[model samples]
Target: MKRRTAREKALQALFQIDISSTEPSAAIEHVLEGERSDDYLSKLVNGVIEHLDEIDQLIKAHLEKWSLERLATVDRNLLRIAVFELKYEHDEVPEKVVLDEAIEIAKLYGDDQSSKFINGVLSKVKQHLF
Candidate 1:
């Protein structure tokens, strides 16, 4: 699968896990709809799950007034996936690409303000990480 498609699937799976407390494999399967799972997709979901506390901490720190739980499901999971990539996959994916991809994904799946909100928060995260 294309990385973008994998990312979208990962976002959906993570969103499910976050909102419904679904099992990761089940969530991933539900999102895949019988399509073969991609390695990147698994890595994303599992990585996010494994590092959830740290990822949420990073998000919580950068959030201006909003808390992590208050974030929309799509917005929250998008940030998690992007933050996972930014933290662990930076050697493979540029921070700019990660940020841009997160913004684009947020635009597609998030509410009207989601893109800007994600961008702002992620930019802060990027600065902090680098």
Candidate 2:
């Protein structure tokens, strides 16, 4: 799968895991809907799950006034996926690409403000990391 598609699927799966407390494999399978499983998609979901606390802490640290829990479900999980890539997949994916992808995905799946909100927070994250 393309990385974009993988990210989208990962966001969906993570959103499920966040909202319903679904098992990771079950969430991934539900998102795949009989399509072939993807390595990147699995990596994203599992990576986010594995480092959830760290990822959340990173986001929480960057957030201006917003608590992690106050974030919309889509925004929160999408941030987790992007932050995972930014932290763990830095050698594989450029930070700019990760930020851009997160913004685009936010535009598609989040409120009108979500893309801007994601961009702002992730830019801070990139600065801190780099």
Candidate 3:
């Protein structure tokens, strides 16, 4: 699968796991819809779940007056995946790429203001990280 498709599927799996407390592997399978899973997809979901606490703390740090749990699910998980990639996969993924991907995905799956909100918080997180 393309990286974009992989990111989208990873977000869906993370969403499922967030809402239902489903196992990360099962959530990945559910999103795969029986298609063969890609390495990037598994890497994204597993990486995000494995480091959720640290990711959430990063998000909460960058948020302005908004807590992580209060954010919309799509927005929350989108930020989580982006933050994970930014922090853990920085050697492989560029910061601009992670920020841009999260913004675009937020535009598609998040509320109207989600892209703007995500951009702001992630920019801060990026500044702090890099």
Which candidate has the highest lDDT of all? 2
Candidate 3 vs. true structure, TM-score: 0.98
The local distance difference test score of each candidate is 0.95, 0.96, 0.93
RMSD, one per candidate, in order: 0.6, 0.5, 0.6
Q: By TM-score, how accurate is candidate 2?
A: 0.99
**Best TM-score among the predictions, by candidate number:** 2
Per-residue CA lDDT of model 3 for 31-127, tens digit only, reads 9998997999999999998898999999998889998889999999999999999999999999999999999999999988999999999999999
- Looking at candidate 2, what is the lDDT of residue 9? 97
- The C-alpha stretches of model 2 lying farther than 4 A from their native spots are none
Candidate 3 ranges with C-alpha deviation above 4 Å? none
lDDT of 1 by residue, 87-129 (tens): 9999999999999999999989999999999999999999999
Which residue pairs collide, candidate 2?
none
- Give candidate 1's error at residue 127 in angstroms: 0.3
lDDT of 3: 0.93
Which stretches in model 1 have alpha-carbon errors above 4 Å?
none
For residues 5-44, write the lDDT of model 2, one tens digit per residue.
9999999999999999999999999999999999999999
User: On a 0 to 100 scale, what is the lDDT of residue 114 in model 3?
Assistant: 94
